[model samples]
Target: MRGRLRGIRLAVPLLLSAAVVACTTTVPGEPVSQGRVISRDQPGGVDPKSVVENTDGGEIDRLAATVVADLRTYWGERFPETFGKEFTDLGGGYYSVDTADADAPEPPCTDSAVEVEGNAFYCPTADIIAWDRAALLPVLKDRFGEAAVMLVLAHEMGHAVQNRTGAGLSERRADPERFPTILIEAMADCYAGAFIRWVVDGNAEHLQFGHDQLDSALTAVVSFRDPIGTEATDRGAHGDAFDRVSAFLDGYESGVKLCSEMTVDNRTFTLSGFIDAGDAARGGNLEFGQIVESITLSLNTYFAEVAGSGWRQPQVRETEGQPACTPDRQGPVAFCPDGAAVELDVAEELPEIHDEIGDYATGTLITSRYALASLAAAGKPVAGPEAQRAAVCLTGAFTGSLFQREQQFLSPGDMDEAIQVLLHYDYVARDVDGASVETGFDRVTLFRKGFVSGARDC
Candidate 1:
């Protein structure tokens, strides 16, 4: 089961659109909110005879039961086919703990009820899964909605699956390099992805997600990602947002076999701990002013290497509000071909974003404009749908450079900020006329390609 040392709070801010594109993008269709994906109307309480019968979390109990029942049904059919053997149900059964009550019973792996606060885990030895319904589930639902609770429990079930398939604790610890904590965590995330696909395909008994809800569900997944700067080799390592989402998307798109095939050799992680003293000194963030200066030079250097002598570096113009442009764009950042320059409202807009999201968010904006410039250097159009897609793809390529430790470094939480911005606004991935060409899913998928394959691929 996935575990956490402390409670993590993910506070997402409002998204604002920026810029104007030559032709407006086809806004993606959205799903109407129909309350929770896993409705709290299940017939039986979650593990009826379990501790939940004595607790006050009836709504959560119903949701948990619905998800667990569906999870069991899915694995019951899939596991036997995958392993050529029958799946074994957990004998120790499911459990819930009221972490807030001192008199509540402790889980198998813990000494006291309070120890289960803010956590959920699957104990392989006892063949049971436990959760702090009072503390963990409520807080997760509040921050990320019911989808998160489903994800957490599904991840725990993934651990149970591992135990039954010979890849248990002994296997995990026996070969730390092959099955490190991070990779193990990623596999569970991938399994969760696989299970989510079953639900998305209309196969689950009690849950269904619409297009927009799945997008929100992806946001929920992002929130559970490991803290930035956590090394992949660390004992408690889960993964950086990019790595975690990549694993989940892999399973979501490809299915269970992909998750089962994961290994340290095959899987790549962008998550990093402290690289050196300079990083430690800065607390994994570059100052806003410093970021602008550093990124401009870096962008020019990168494009020159990729586009050769034809590459003409755009002059970086700092602005306080919307810059004067053809038909004027809506965002604080704009790319102008007339002057062969990019204008940034660094006075408040850029700095505010930098302070709120992290330096890479500003980096994504800078690189996207530079991406337009790269297209211009190649004699590619900067005003159409292709241009918009290319710009986002190039921004992704530049982001990939951070993983490689090229010039600028990607601090912790940078990827999360990128996802947050992509979901909330469109400015960072817009074209010359200020229109976004892709859905949040498409934008992220294309960016993932560029990130994995580099600028040459873009």
Candidate 2:
């Protein structure tokens, strides 16, 4: 997985800055978007052929047009409610380009349609949003579903909202340190999250969004994550997968108020460059066995010290296949209570994941069982949902601790690796009974709680 493309760079729409004033509103309103409500009734029947210029009115463009209309519904109410201003339509009309067609009209901020190929952007100067109907939207819809298209459009519209609120690109450039690009991008994500939540809450009129769609939304968002090793303070940096997801989740969980309130001082961005050139040369990954040895030792020290009195370290053993636990299958690894051993399959399974997702994926999986053992030692039951969640949380806590290590420390993309694993797998949140958390979102939430607040929060 080191060289494989895990996330697409599709998330980088042109980001200018934004600002806002205060307003008041209430929730508990009827929504018109799809999925939960499953509404197909369009308020005025959005026609991209007329509304968007240079359009073929193809399926992708039609979908994008619907997303734009829904954005109007959500933000028309949201903007005035949150920013104390009446919402206004874009001064510049939306544009759609058939990048595959040489005759397609050029969109704002680009000299030719070729430049906008496989891209979507909000041109701050022109106050317009444009997209490559031929490439970007279709691929997102195909790979991640309609919600991905919805979220991407929402994110681009978020740029317009930023400008409307007076935090336009000019303000961002005026105060780069205070309103860095990362924060701007995060705030935009948060706004998109707010829009998604609005739709999921059944407030949209032209789209459908449900609980199951969140995973697809997240998967799509992460694909747009910043290039590995981007510093949080870099002028053009968006953020790593974890940070980007965190921003989006914050918006989904909270609201525009919370998103608008984000500051460099208040937000936590876990993005940075490699500690050294040698570490970068190695791709910031330790060998499989070496990672297991190092993290196992760190886990023992971390749990022993954190759990304190009555916490006993468990033995680590490797097996060819599954562990010999009496019951319950813990994927490739298990914490055995009968013999007090953390057993794992070392022959094949782990090495593949190690090579596929980086060594830290294996390390994080191993860390969870170690966390389970610590839970058991602390007299906590190890066979329930609470235990499973706690173990995952502690795994995150331990991963966080690796940041400060003098040696065997976390590499630049380690947390992103952890994010990828937790987003795709449930093994980290499995208890001895094999019971697990219900969703990847919940598991990631628990892990994030631990990472942000440390083991104490877990």
Candidate 3:
């Protein structure tokens, strides 16, 4: 796990810097140059081929052009109606020819030679949506069928939509444990569905997916799901098949309102009364203990399936009468061989504690939303509508579980170690009125902004 962690750097695209705006420049004979294109205030270098190919590269290019144009038109009208703001066109930039040989370094615009497998990306850096012709094109033709090619464009364009809206910027410096990569990718998928829905409604003549073709499109989407939930982490944000399809359907069925509702936010939770009561008996805040117990239980269950039966509980014995080791002892003093009691020195233990446990807060956030919503729907007072709204803020933390899992996979350890790491932190909750809600551990801060007013205690 440590080796995996060492290799796992957050592959957040360079374009993820929220401050940088993508620039577009036109090359002579480019399609965007011919269109009613809105140029950026500060133009950056662009690949000429990207623009030229869309205008002149036959059916695929034409199809790509139409998709881009239609999405622009759709959102241009939709944004004003929904948010009372006009949509700004981020200039579509073109790519130049490849200077590298077949085996040499490939140009950004020459997608044909690039490796596309497991790499469906939107290059905000280039201001061009590129598909590795070497990889993705073949998959579209053979496995996903011809229509999928358009869907793929729509999906990539969906990311472009996020960029146009402020959502892309909001998600820029995403804390892996605090934000779920799956949701981000899923939102893009939903945006694609919204675009498709627009096509089905607005321009059926230009673009059409037959019932059978729709099935194929659905299958194409299902192909991207990660079988194991391990991929739920931030670096591996594309969700499992079930979540991917669900998000797409969420947008397809209900449209933008549902999609908007899907954005990540900070949510809060109260410690259960039982857990609080137990803490009262211990004469110390039980919040940390409760968190540890919950995490330990969850990790134990998780590892039991993934690591199998070889997973052993760490032996913790009472240290009251532990014998002092002799100088002749060769092994490190941390381990107690005879008594099986590990004396954890608090000062030393504090620093060695892996802050990774904060990852659990994200997981808890993810799992708790649905749990709270379900509770509210089923008449749980604490999770009722007002509280549910407050609870929704925690979504950012919950979705963050995906990112945490990636970190965990990188530095695999016993479940107890993971729990101990997480238990060191605290959960804070604040009321919607901006007053601190006291929980046993400490006054949990309300991290959410713009919450609805007049909500009762959560």
Candidate 4:
């Protein structure tokens, strides 16, 4: 994983910053972008060109080629009108490499095939896009599905779009502030979001997306976000997960025009590469034990305000093995009405999940239970559809508190972890009957409401 991380730096396009305004209008009649909507008619993957090699007629290359083709078509038509200039297709075209093949030919802008391992990138000087078909695509496909792969390609093509504008590598080097790397990366991310919207709208000939895939695509994009605490001004900065998602959402909700209009003045990113000695010593994350204790104290303080003076801190019980809550309230963790306590299967489930996701995943689980307690204290039933929604909303509220940098600090990747858990499982969103929000799309939207506006919104 570390090696792959290192290769990412090598594979990505050189960086730049930008300045622009938000576009208020997009396509006709489609004033608002249709977020998380899938196309009714599916246009399968594209045909592979001769530049792609080492494929035994596999679908991955065809998919990449198809996405590339559609992207060029979208930009080719949209770019001229948006920028008042002719859009240029990648001069060097697309190249697919089988990094696993020792004898495989190296792609342009690379010294060796190994450089492409676990990565994909676009070379501005050469005006070409390339990928490690054998390594990167398959891994992303397995981890986040094919939409992720499309997103990667789309993001790179976004870079090509940037080059077509006036902010290519030479322009960025000329004026770093005018085209900083973070802003440049955000623009690409936004462009990818816009392109994905095009696909979702059934306009593309070879790509399709739905709400579930949208969540997964967001997940994949978050995974590639610069590490938490990375400064927006850093040379390699690509925006924090929050900033990246916000940009993507802007494009999805608005359109390509909004993506083209993004500027540093209008954007806010939470990640800061610089940290004080105290935080540096902790490596941007608290241990599992410390996380539990700190979150427990924080939740008690927060809900005290929400539930009035009557908010009672539930007794936290950590049991071995998986939680064995009654079928009426089944989940990895639970808030027991009978005992007025929160129960966690800490020994294996909590710790393992924490390790798999991050501290915030556990934090989200525990906080959701606390949310139920808050509902109960406020004279609200903890066993209805509304209660379920309230629970998820309160979890978002707590997450918002963390976002505000309250008593409990959010680790760099914590928000992304919260997003992952919410989308991956419904344990935190469930009601007494083990029912919760049916779609990750709605679940994340509600969470975002509380996260952006605070508990009052919930």
Candidate 5:
């Protein structure tokens, strides 16, 4: 039985913001006004007239609509043929709200709610889907890729599918013990994969997932897993990495039937289970390895046949350089041809900026690059000594205020705020070199300023 619990809050603001954006627009082929996007922040605050200016909201909504439409079409056709019942249209809505609005009444049949720490979730009670775009989307873009936005939408939609079949809420409430928590979450993962397969298989128009794109999707799925082997059911809303990948593979291979086959009793665990079991064995618990290995090997064999040999051990080759060595070729090292030395320590030559900034500021590299690119694109003079470049990059008028605000405190809320400001600035500043000089900031100069400020502060 899947664990029965009240829907977890979708507290991640970025994700909710993204979902708000996604729920506003219609799918490419579908009519546009079918769904409405609500900024939970602006429940009554989201000006109806401002919808036109809500470009991000619109983009997210449109993308979500596309995914929703595709799912409807795929299941509409498939479900009827398989089960003799037309797939019910689970309407979608996006809400960005505070705690007060979160508990407010929801739309019928399908709705989702999103907040700062809550992440994203689908509510069966309201039959609505909600996400915190403010919390999730930015992280998705930074950690995964823009395509990960779609993966998120797919996950929520999987919940909607569960609602339609009455599998999600029922099993969650009634038979949780019969269905291990992992299997239930794995089913949703598989459903997400099925949607991806539908898109990549060309069943859906203009939606494609390339190999690189698939890697992004795979990464997004894998990141949700629990690293520890403890089968603590209540906390396992999503399966671990290996299980996620395999569940996705199950959908991609055998299609929807594989999803239908997932039940409380006979579900598979992740490949990492084998590794964990192996560790337990070395620690004198051979039974653990034997038990886990049998399950993993069996699942691997099944998926190998279903998804073909390629699914058994998908190879990932490095595109820009040799997989084993970075460009410098230093041991922890790289070969430096310019220095004409096989063992020259390039690590020393590389700037010690990362070390100086500390782990908390690790994302500064991306921020610096983006700031520089924006400034250079806008014709700002960024070239000079390293110190000059860093200064120019760090102290620009646009982001300087943000940096100041961030430096004032270090609470969890403050840290999150700082990260959002930096990430937003970085995302908008990407590839500014192509924009008109009058329009964009000078990327190089801006980066140099930022780098200097950061260095000086350190």
Candidate 6:
């Protein structure tokens, strides 16, 4: 009953036709290696409060001060090399607002101190950056760690980079076609990714982020995604989680050159919302059983098309717990090549993932097993790095193809769900031997490759 074809009644909202063109950001480098995350405080050379306005010398302010100081140092060195010009520090200076403090002075570029609460941003005209040290930085640090705080300032600093480069500003935004807010936000995110990479590579004088933590850093990145149904071309649209993560990784993997070169024509934007009222009312969600039923059929049909005459459909079954394999154990879901079957834990994890992340997380996990089966049918080994790469890539390829179909089954946040699963879990990248790709960032990269470049790349 789990994998049985139940007449294709899946709920996918919005057309993915917007997801066109292969990703132009093919960075040349080995994936970021996995190891223990190296996070440490900056060596004190100067007081952060001396540089930042309205600073109380709190822990968050110290962290932010060091981060900004490092940002200045990074851009100072890189800007001349990349742009044939010298980098200039913020003219108006940085401002740290204690939003909870009623008597605190107003932050630059904003009228009220409350306006700066729980937010961080670059004020282009004033050439200043401001943040809520009290609320925003604390919460970001609490939830996603210090890297989250670094990511925020780096992104705002990226806006400063754009302002100097003439790529961003209200005057230039008259032509929404070329300068959409989403694209601008993407460029900022890409720049942040590039800076984070510098920190990750042990280049920052004040920061040392482990490559292993890039996954959580990215998790912090997607937390800034624009709310669903926000039009991609809207004046303030920031982009969906998938697009945001893609741009960020483009910078991390490819460097600032790729971030600088981004444009509307070159990037894909799949940020549309529900078209059918019925689906909208239902929140574009199919029940767990319905999701499993519809997605399994969809995956089967999709892979069959890819493999053409050679595709052998893998058996599907729901076990009380994880399915037994001789030695392979792929978390809650396991792909048993010995029996040519995909066994999932109906009793736990998958359902929780669907309930927590969304329907597509489960779909992404299920699709990878079929990817291994397809590899086996094609006489390829399903137990190595190649298999691991192909599994996630194939999963992305299948997800990408949904946009091309007349029958739409992927909703707005579904791609985000896929990303969530890729970043949070390794099951999608698991080989038949139960070994999986090590880094979530790398897993996302491989999955993004198939989605952006299509199945042919896989």
lDDT of each: 0.69, 0.75, 0.38, 0.70, 0.40, 0.74
Positional deviation of residue 268's Cα in model 1 after best superposition, in angstroms: 1.7
lDDT of 1: 0.69
Q: Estimate, for each residue in 133-230, the C-alpha lDDT of model 1 and write its tens digit.
A: 88777666666567777888888888888887767777866876777777777788889888988887878767765555665566666666665667
Q: Per-residue alpha-carbon lDDT of model 4 for 334-431, expressed as tens digits?
A: 88776368878877767887887777788888898898889888888888778888888889887777666633367566776787677667888887
Considering summed lDDT, which 10 consecutive residues are worst modelled in model 2? 20-29
C-alpha positional error of residue 157 in candidate 4 after TM-score superposition, expressed in Å: 1.3
Off by over 4 Å in 1: 1-35, 39-57, 305-310, 326-330, 337-339, 405-408, 437-439
Give the distance in Å from residue 256's predicted Cα in candidate 2 to where it truly belongs. Answer: 0.5
Model 1, residue 300: displacement in angstroms? 1.9
Candidate 4 residue-wise lDDT at 444: 70
lDDT of 4 at 257: 83
For model 4, the run of ten residues with the poorest summed lDDT: 21-30
In model 4, where do residues sit more than 4 Å from their true spots?
A: 1-44, 50-58, 77-86, 100-107, 111-114, 227-231, 239-243, 273-282, 308-313, 317-330, 379-386, 406-408
lDDT of 6 by residue, 1-458 (tens): 11222110000111111211001111111233232222444455336777798899977888888888889999998888878899999998999988898778986566677766667777777788888777777776766677777888888888889888877565355576787777877888899889988988888877788877888677776676655556666655677778888888898889888888888889887666765665566566667778777887778888887777778887888877667663337867777867468888888878888888877788888888888878877777889899999999999999888866665567767777888888878889988777889988899999899988888899
Give the per-residue lDDT of model 2 (tens digit) for 1-458.
12111112543434322321111111111221223223566633467886688888777777788888888888888888899989898888788888888877887667678777666777777888887778777666666667777777787788788887866778776887888877888888899999988888877777767776676677777677766677777766778777888888889999898888888899878777776676677777878777877677668889998777877778888888777773337778888975378888888777887888877788889999988888877888888878988999999888877765545466767777888778777889999878888777777778888887799888
Candidate 3 per-residue C-alpha lDDT over 264-353 given as tens digits, one digit per residue, 9 for 90 to 100: 553211111111333224322223224333443443343233223444433322222321321212111122323223222223222223
- Alpha-carbon error at 298 in model 3, in Å? 21
> TM-score of every model?
0.85, 0.89, 0.44, 0.79, 0.47, 0.88
Number of backbone collisions per candidate: 9, 18, 26, 9, 93, 1
Query: What are the C-alpha RMSDs, in order, of all predicted structures?
Result: 9.5, 6.5, 18.9, 8.0, 19.1, 7.4
lDDT of 5: 0.40
* Residue runs of model 5 more than 4 Å from their true location after superposition: 1-56, 91-118, 227-229, 232-237, 271-458
